[model samples]
Target: MTAPDWAESALALLVHRAGGTAAQVGSRFPLYADPDDGRWTTTGRGSWTGGFWAGLLWLRARHRAGLGAADLLAASACTARLAPWARADTATRGLILWYGTALAVADPGADALRARAARAALDAWDPRLGLVPWGAALGGERLRARADGVPGLVPLLTSAGPTGARAAGAHLRRHLELCLPGAGGRPRPSWRYDTTAARWAEDTEPGPGWTRGEAWLLLAVADALLRVGTLEGSPTRPPNDLAEAAEQLLESGEFLTGPLVPPADTRRPAGPPDTSAAAIAAVALRKLALVPAAPWAAACATRSDTVLRHLADTRLTRPTHPAGGRPGGMLLDGCYDPAGHTAPSHELIWGDFFLALALAALRGDVDLTRV
Candidate 1:
């Protein structure tokens, strides 16, 4: 079968396995299955949300590939009601809008879905702040600051059109200019709202313990840069500054382990490294590769491939929940409890979705019709 066929089949199987009806899965409730235990669970909540977007993207691709109106309508409806919370955040709202608009283009009967998506997108936008808030927070201050620059820029660049994208890009560049560390310097992963001090501060004292924080910043920026390239209709010519940032990140290589280890940190075996970070890094590299002449593109792609392979081979790509199971369940290695007090760490939908996306992108299988 073609890639589109494979994606369609995979999506169908995934929706079915989640216990959704064919119409529901194919229509507006793409990722809304309740848990098997009939309880609120976080296992499949994360990336599963993306499934709704993925389903819509897939349907549109299928139509482009010559599917019939009946099939298109079914997919459109499934895309419509999959996530009510799409109205709550800019990222999701943009995704729903993008998908919904595509559906409407293919099947005019999907006007309702398009309207709902538009309303959600409007609600997510914050005119006063000049940027869409991720969610309904007082001023979106917390969300904006927490997201830093990277995530905030994605929707603007990729999902939003040139106007919104340019505006958002300018805002992000200004924010980073003021807040980020000097060139060739490292900033804290993030800052906290120090109510008393009335400003943000590096959460941790100077040290090497901020690997994850750095990873987040690097990955986010790398992704935004890539999106900018794609948005500008110059997929092969990314911004040079963005390219440098990515190269700096790649050069860090803190997460990549050779055979040797520091004597003090010998207790922990660094055989495979953090699967999650590796996954994120793989995606970053792929984005950087959009710029064909990017000096670091080849190396980044090579490293990303290695990391992706390691992640897939290590069972990190396994579904968050087992097959033939009920909804609202966790996968074996799905969740993680940072506090280590309560909450079981089980396989989660969010992690799995990202892993799938990263893997799919790496394999040049980004056409959702295959996923």
Candidate 2:
């Protein structure tokens, strides 16, 4: 069978495994739960809350399965209003807008939902610094300095439109000025914000060397470029900064080649090579391939193919360590520590969901080109 067929089957399985309903997944699980204070918290699972990414992934899966826009809107409304952890955080807002916009594009009725999401995104903004605060709880942290720059940017670009996109672009440009390494001409792999120092870190610190930091940036740049391309009238040019960043990520395969290395400060590795990161990279690489003679386009194409193949061939969706294994599949590798105090080491549904969407996009593109 072709890749698309395999992807379809995998998606179906995932939806089924996750209970396959339009309703949002509850925020409470073995490793993830809501704090008594209503804050979403993770134990050992990193970035696996039932917020925007997962909701968007579900919509994509349902769309591929022949679900209509109305169905998607219904599902999205459930996601937006029902998900217990759907607070005003970066991930939640990003997913809300991204998925909500997608729903709007499919069903005009979802314009309200889209508007709500956009408003939420806009409200999260900090006018003084002109950047969206990472979250209300984090005291208005910016994406560039928090977690990894890329993860924050991914949802931002995916959700924003002409006005919102431009605003996001401005904020990102400022972020690059402060956090980016080297001259402003090219993109670098890592960004730093010192929680201790309460400012952008002066040096490139991969922090115990989490591989996803680089991968997240690569995905974010690609996503930003794609959004910029959708603007009206004027021809869209791939941002030179993002193009350069893509090249750096592909070249830094040393970290991507194997399991994540444990930070020097810690004993265990973070987990695996973030299957979701690889999936996001694959889609981003495909988008990069659209640029004419762009130096990184070919490399991005090659990486996309390789990453997609690896995901299909390897049991990456399963657990990596003995401790992670259970009746259900083990969490894939490459996740940060969930406890926010230690390294992450469990299988997360969000990664699997996004990986499926990436595969679907790749397969869809290949099919479109073949015709």
Candidate 3:
């Protein structure tokens, strides 16, 4: 009946899926589950989404139902295993570290691992680009950047205290500059500064304005701004101007509730509706309302509630797998473009994670932004 009830359901399902997923895929990092066949794919620590399983466990155990000692140990093991990824060349180090380091900071045993990850992020700074390189190639020929990197990257950087503040500030500024300008300097989600070609290129999706990328960039910026406000003892650089941050929150809120009601991969009518994007936007908007300079807070809150209602229904939600190992996958019809081909449109792990997070925020389970 209420958001908490849905979150409670999701919490139970997460635990069920965690146990079964561990049995099915073991500790090798369950990256994805085939929506139709229910086969799990393991990508080890290299995959960006790999941390979500451990993240889900931590969120379920810490925020929702408490896990048993054995499960907590398993979750802790996953965090320890991810330590090597701190030195990984990609921008997703934050994605890998967020849940783990958040857990680490809470559980005093993880201090060294947290410090290691902080150094990895510190090493990612590319002064030429004024931010960390988006692609793993780094100083190599291919120079790439992405909107998705910020949401996952910034938190880990901020969590490092003053050590990461200067770099985090630089990254956010570069990210905004890279937001390809539409008519009248409106920010699009992504663009490429082709260092090799010496020209700027627009980063596109199925069509103009990748809805998910836009949501990630804009909402993530707002989330970053929110973090700058609430950080107690940690030293974090203040993000872009308050007016600029407000503009981003306003733009994101407007786009999310715009004509493309159930936002798809692209804003186009023909584009496949990505319920995952909508879910991400829902959490972003809800969290956006909490930030200092954000306007239309009540309106944004209303839109996020509407989005969650849809996600809670049969349309975006898929039933738990008949056999097991998958449960209450919240947002359906997700689009992921891997190098070789487009991954199937199914429930994205981050989608489910954010949707549950949104519900948690709405029901006062977790502080979505500050965490």
Candidate 4:
């Protein structure tokens, strides 16, 4: 089938899957689901992945606007529920707040929440670290930086003001310097601060091979470029050089050349594939394609389409599949913490969000960059 055809089918299945998810999770957020039965392990407080759940609800609401007000009310309530995260001491507020509100059109509540999150993130910024600390709120080192912390924060910070824009630039630049030490290798996804020595050290847990690491950083770069491009070189703009840095990385990243869906960790090639990473990369590529004057636009768009198609055709569960007895539309084979043996092959909430987002983009239901 064609792009629209496949994307439409995928979107329909995902919407159906989301309905079941909403019913199952109720007020909580769905984290990941068992690949066999599509049963989700939920979080009461809308953890790091919670915004994706909220985002998926918004996406469904938009896709089915004509159906009724049920989806819209669900999306709004979920967005409102995320207010508590605005005060939480986590860099993931970027993920939680930005995605949670970006697509919420004409909702002053969402707008206020976005503004609150941007200011909160700005307050969390550290001049010494040049980025927001990964934060102790998540039970990690308070002075650590991770690849996952950078993506939505770029735009989130830029929303605050000129100072926030500069902070946004510095945050992304610092992460790029630490995570991507040089040209042509996997990204070091996390780094810890040596408080006594006042030095930063590469973190071992995520390591260089973590599948989503590169994708997360790449998405941040894409966001930086898109936001800078909008500025057109004003005095209040972020480091103009950031646009250049982002473009270069997008052009040369190895994640683009490897398998569309890579392993959870490159170090363990036989491990479960993280389709979530591929989905994240697909959305990033699509956003990159929208960058003005980006030479790689055509290639990025092509690669994005290929990746999304692969996910829809293979990884996404379907009711009609020969081995399928499970609910359809659940994106399977997403590895969550392969090293910890935690839900190594399951349906990740973020995986489902990005997949649906990509499909929505293909079907002309939403703007890829705006969200």
Candidate 5:
């Protein structure tokens, strides 16, 4: 499919792949599929990426057919599995509830789920550190903060409605405040806020500014700013540092682009740039563009478009993925731990799901307020 036909073709393929996968394993949480063999694995609902497969189903069901009793059953099963996660065993409840359950199911009981999610987010907030602590109610050192955690928590709090939203926004603001100091110009990855020792240690892997972690930070902060504005019905002034931080990360995001923009030798590995991060930034930048407070809106949107086009091109997108897996199904070269080879050179469910999300965002079908 050409630029004009990309979304349609993408949607059609997703419907087919997801439908086929559903037929193969209904209501199973598909975490990742081997790009080489198309072998799928089922993870528990509480897994960090468990929501994404269901999320893919929900995204496609919006635009196509083949959804009936099976869709409802799948949705109900997902909700049932995720229901206990309201208090959230992990900080990824935002990922689960927003993607896995929010759009897919609408039973009246779902309201309780939303409330549970909101409470979980609130509970994760650490008053002293001013950011949500990572992990559950464990004792000892007791202060861990990850850039990725911000994304999964902010949406739940911002969407909490009249009760805790402003405070939730305040809590999100704290996360923005506590981001690790930048190296060259870009932000670093994570933080170990040792409330026990009252010291802060840079928590980036192999040093500062891990690729995917930085992208998560960029998108998470931008999303938080935009989300708070819509929730409180108040105008949000762009936090200059947060906005600039996003711009810097977007520059680093050039690493994801295939040598298009200048400064050619990014000096990283020279294959497919992390499409997972690129897809995420694409959708995130487009969403940021919609926010009046956001800066560099036009440039970010254009970059988003460029990433989408690159990802959609056959060289990157394994369009014929679901049927015959030949090491290039959907988006390829995903980096679970780029430095550590834990998840590399495969099509991650999150990567594929966000690629669909980026396409949907381009088509104006995504509701950032709801999603």
Candidate 6:
């Protein structure tokens, strides 16, 4: 089959699956679903994953635009549901606010929501810390930095203005300097600030081989690389910092080259693979491919297409059932947390979002660079 043949089918499956998920979850947000029965573990407040649900809805609305207006209305309602997260102190407001609103074009509500999130994030920024501290709104260390805090933030902060651009630059640079070591070393996924010592200490939870950590930080670097020229103020970091960060992440992400899907943690090679990480990396690579004149642009694009194809062939479920039943389109083998044995192999909401996004990009229904 051709690229579009598989991509279109996969996209359709994912969107259909999103419709079923919407019907079942209603107001709640899905985190991960059981691989066997398609039963979801839901959250009332949408947590950090809520935006991905909204994003999938927007994709479905765009995909079925002429079919009916219901999907669009559903997407809008879901975006509105994400409003309260704007005031949450977590740096993941980028994940919640930016993604929750980015794809909804000409939406006044989404526009207002994005603006509100940008300002909230700007206010949350700690100038002394040189970045938005990994916030405590979700219950964790308020002065720590994690790889998950950076991706959606780049665009969210840049939308605020030059000050925000500077903050965005500093945020990415600070995380890169601390989490990723020099000379192409492996990445550490988390760091906490020790006030007594006034320095950053590496957290042991995520370990060195956390697959999602590498993918998340790479996505952030790709975002920065695409917007390199916009950070114009006194410059917390060099302009080339973005490119350097991308290069480091590309070198460190081994799954980008092989296995397509990787273990939840590379430290345990025999563990279940996290298709979510691969999906995220595929989107990031597609974004990187859009960076003009980059030496690796062609390579990134090819690898991205290959990764998406591999997932479509292997991970994405087929749409053989009707919409009312346990419809297909679950992107399985997504390891939420291997150490804690939490949903070690299931269908993740973000996994579904990225897989749908990549397939939509392939079929020309959406722009990978923008969303």
Choose the strongest candidate by TM-score: 6
Report model 2's TM-score to 2 decimal places. Answer: 0.67
lDDT of 4 by residue, 104-178 (tens): 856888899999999999999999889999998889679999999999999999999888988988898899888
Residue-level lDDT of model 2, residues 1-371, one tens digit each, is 24556555554454443442223234332222121111223322223333433354444545445654544544444444423223446634453344333422344444455555555666666555556545543334344443243343444443555666665665555555553445322234334456576555433434424444445555555556555554222345666665665565555433234332222222234323345455555655666666655776675667666766666556344322455233222224435442254334334445555555565565452221110
TM-score rank order:
6, 4, 5, 3, 2, 1
Segments of candidate 2 deviating more than 4 angstroms: 1-9, 20-48, 52-74, 82-92, 99-111, 138-144, 147-161, 182-199, 202-208, 230-233, 252-273, 316-331, 334-343, 365-371
> Candidate 6: where are CA atoms >4 Å away?
1-3, 232-238, 320-326
Lowest summed-lDDT stretch of 10 residues in model 6? 231-240
Q: Per-candidate RMSD vs. true structure?
A: 7.4, 7.1, 4.0, 2.6, 4.0, 2.6
lDDT of 6 at 67: 84
lDDT by residue (260-334, candidate 5, tens digit) is 212111235453346577677776777777768455778777777777777767424444555554533356656
Q: Point out the worst 10-residue segment of candidate 3 by lDDT.
A: 230-239
Candidate 6: tens digits of C-alpha lDDT, residues 1-371: 23478788888889888988998899999999998779899999999999999999999988887887788889999999999999998999999888889989558999999999999999999988889988998897899999999989988999999899999989988999898865656799899999999999999988788989999998998888777778654323335667777877888877356578988888899998999999999999999888877777899999999999999899887755555455589999999888899999999999999988888877777876666
Instruction: Work out candidate 6's RMSD over C-alphas.
Output: 2.6
The clash numbers for all candidates, in the given order, read 19, 12, 0, 0, 0, 0
Give the distance in Å from residue 62's predicted Cα in candidate 3 to where it truly belongs.
Answer: 2.1
Where does candidate 5 stray beyond 4 Å?
1-3, 65-69, 136-142, 183-185, 204-207, 230-233, 236-241, 252-272, 293-295, 315-329
Q: Write the per-residue lDDT of candidate 1 for residues 215-301, one digit (tens) a residue.
A: 445556665565655445565566766666555555443433421111111122332223334444555556655545667667666
In angstroms, give how far residue 205 of model 2 lies from its true place. Answer: 8.6
CA lDDT of every candidate = 0.42, 0.46, 0.62, 0.86, 0.62, 0.87
Q: Give the clash total for candidate 4.
A: 0
Q: After superposition, how far is residue 262 of candidate 4 from its true place, in Å?
A: 0.3
